[model samples]
Target chain A: MKARIRITLKNGVLDPQGKAIQNALGSLGFAGVSDVRQGKYIEIDLAATDEAAARAEVDRMCRELLANTVIEDYAFELAKP
Target chain B: MKTSVIVFPGTNRERDVADVLAAVTGSPAQIVWHGDSEVPQSDLIVLPGGFSFGDYLRCGAMAAHSPIMRDVVAKAKAGVPVLGICNGFQILCETGLLPGILQRNASLKFICKDVWLKVENTQTQYTRRYNQGEVARMICAHGDGNYFADPSTLDRLEGDGRVVFRYCDPKGNVTAEANANGAQRNIAGIADPTGRILGMMPHPENAAEPMLGSVDGRKLFESLLAA
Candidate 1:
């Protein structure tokens, strides 16, 4: 089984890196890009046979290590082989 | 008073903190490695600044899960005085020992300079040596010193008087222009509700000597010694 996780800064938290990228895009002749938000995507392979169990495990990982709940939010999807 | 400085891999300010501790208390401070499960008995436990875990994953994320941090967390819960500076402050927040997460600086730069800090609360053990509203010049050097917390948490920290230091100008006005890293409310440092755990983005140890350009940082160590 494989799990993919996406971590992102919370709505109200400032994302300076994303803003920098937005500015760079504007200067490079890319228009109509109103805003940009940066985030992280992580994929992990697990040995669990049960998709439900793997999803639960990955969910725990997201809460514990993959994301800092204070400033970032995380979600995961488990795929079956 | 005895002090123990926890040395995590890549930590470079343990010696600086130990040196200042010894100078202020007339006693040698112990150096404890991150892998050690037990923290040697001491009056104070310090998490010194440096690029712990090479700043991978996040500034102190890996270090916060190290073996010794378990013991440090236990001791902090037992009312030990734990001081976290710069990278140490990041680790403390990572461990949930303190509120707020330090993100990249608003300018996204590694800032290193002496900035004025206003002592917001003098009642805590860490700031007792300075008068309320006193301003001290302290060195802040970090790429991720911008502090962020939820609105409710910010309100609670302020209502409980846990905010210890706020970045300000020479005359002690906390203006947005004076905020070094865009911290909320210009917070430079904060203490836990019990007032024993303190985490700050500034490096007080680096500014403890007069030759270093300012001795205002020495009073923080003196306050701890007196406590």
Candidate 2:
């Protein structure tokens, strides 16, 4: 099974990379770009028995390594293809 | 004093810190590799500055998960004195061993220059060498040195006097220019509750040797020795 973990800066936290992208778009003739925020998308292969277990493990992984709970939020999903 | 400097692949200032440690402690500081799962027994642990793990994902993010960091964290929790320089400061935050994060400079540029810092609280083990309210010249080089934490956290830090250093002008005025990275509350350095672990954006090691420019940084190392 494969799972994807999405991590984002917590609400109200400044996102410099996202702001830079927004600025870049505005300069490239793209108009009315209200805002942009950059985040991470990580995919991992796992052998969990079910979706619930996979998600639980991914959450653990995020807390342990992928996401910094102090400043960032993370969620993961297990999907079969 | 037994001293050890952990050397991650991208750590550029391990030698500089080692030299300072040797000069001040009268004993050579061991250079520990990042791959090592255990930290050597030492009275002090120095996490020197560099773009650890190339600052991948986020500055200090990857290195925080490095094998050596686990050992470092364990030792820190056990009351061993740990000092983190610029990049090391980032790692400390990422590891959740310290509060707050190092955000990018408000000016959106990497700053490399001498900076003046006011000794906020001299009671901590890290700043005991400096007179309370005295100012010292130090070097800061980082793109993401702006420190940010929630309001409550900031209040607790201030209330507890854990804030040990702040940016200041040569005249010792806390001004915007002296705040090289525009950190929240002008904070430059902080200590753990026990004051055993210190994370600061300024690189004292860089200024420890007079030939490098200023020897003002020696006071910090001296403080650690006295501790």
Candidate 3:
């Protein structure tokens, strides 16, 4: 099975990198971009045969290592074997 | 007054901390490797500044799960005096020993300069040498030193007087302009609920010698000896 995770700063948390990117885009003539929030995407290949088991393992990884629950939120999806 | 400084793979400040500890305590400080499962018995445990594990996967996150941190966490919970400076502070937060997360500076730039810090609580063992509200000049060098916590946690930390240091002006005014990293409440340092563990972004060791520009940082080490 394969799993994909997305991590992002929680709402109300300041994203300075995202703001900087937005400014750069505006300067490059990319108008109509109201806001830009940066995040991380991670893909993992797992040996688990069951989709449910893979999802559970990935979720645990997110909580323990991949994402810092204090300032970021994480979600994952498991793909079929 | 023996002290132990944990040395992570990429940590470069252990010698600085050890030098200051020996100078102040009149005893040689031990350097404990991150892979060690046990920390030698000591009066103080210090996590000095520097990029641990190359600041990969967020600052201090990789080092927080190292073998030695398990022992450090246990000792901290048992009321041992644990001091985390700069990168060390980030590790403490990653290990859940401290309350908030350090975010990137608001200006989106790495800040390396001297800043004034107001001692908010002098009752803790770490701040005993300074009078309440006294100001200390220290050096801060970090790209992500902005501290953040939820509203409730911030309130509790303030209510319990756990905020040990706040970024301030030379005259001790905590104005927004004085905040170098956009930390919530201008908090530069904080102690655990028990007051035995402290995590601060400033580099006190760098300012301990007069030749280094300021000796204000020596008071913190002196306080440990007094305690």
lDDT of each: 0.93, 0.89, 0.93
Clashing pairs in 2: none
Q: Per-residue lDDT tens digits of candidate 1, residues A1-81?
A: 888889998998899999999999999999999999999999999999898788788888887777899989898888877
* Pick by DockQ: 1 or 3, better one: 3
Interface CA RMSD, all predictions:
0.7, 1.8, 0.8
TM-score of each: 0.98, 0.95, 0.98
- Candidate 2 falls in which docking quality class? medium
Candidate 1 accuracy as lDDT: 0.93
Q: Stretches of candidate 2 above 4 Å error? A: none
TM-score of 3: 0.98
lDDT of 1 by residue, B1-227 (tens): 88999999999999988999999999999999999999999889999999999998789999999999999999999998999999999999999999889999999889998899999899888888999899999999999999999889999999999999999998999999999999999998999998889999999999899899989998999998666
Q: Candidate 3 lDDT, tens digit per residue, B10-86?
A: 89889988999999999999999999999999889999999999998899999999999999999888878999999
Instruction: Give the residue spans of candidate 3 off by over 4 A.
Output: none
Tell me the spans in candidate 1 whose CA falls farther than 4 Å from its real position: none
Pairs of colliding residues, candidate 3: none
Predicted candidate 2 versus true structure: per-residue lDDT over B1-227, tens digit per residue: 99999988899999889999999999999999999999989999988899998888778998888899999999999999999999999999888888988988877889999999899888877788899888889999999999999999999999998898899999899988778887988999998888888999998998888788888889999998785
lDDT of 2 at B205: 90
- Candidate 1's chain A scores what TM-score? 0.95
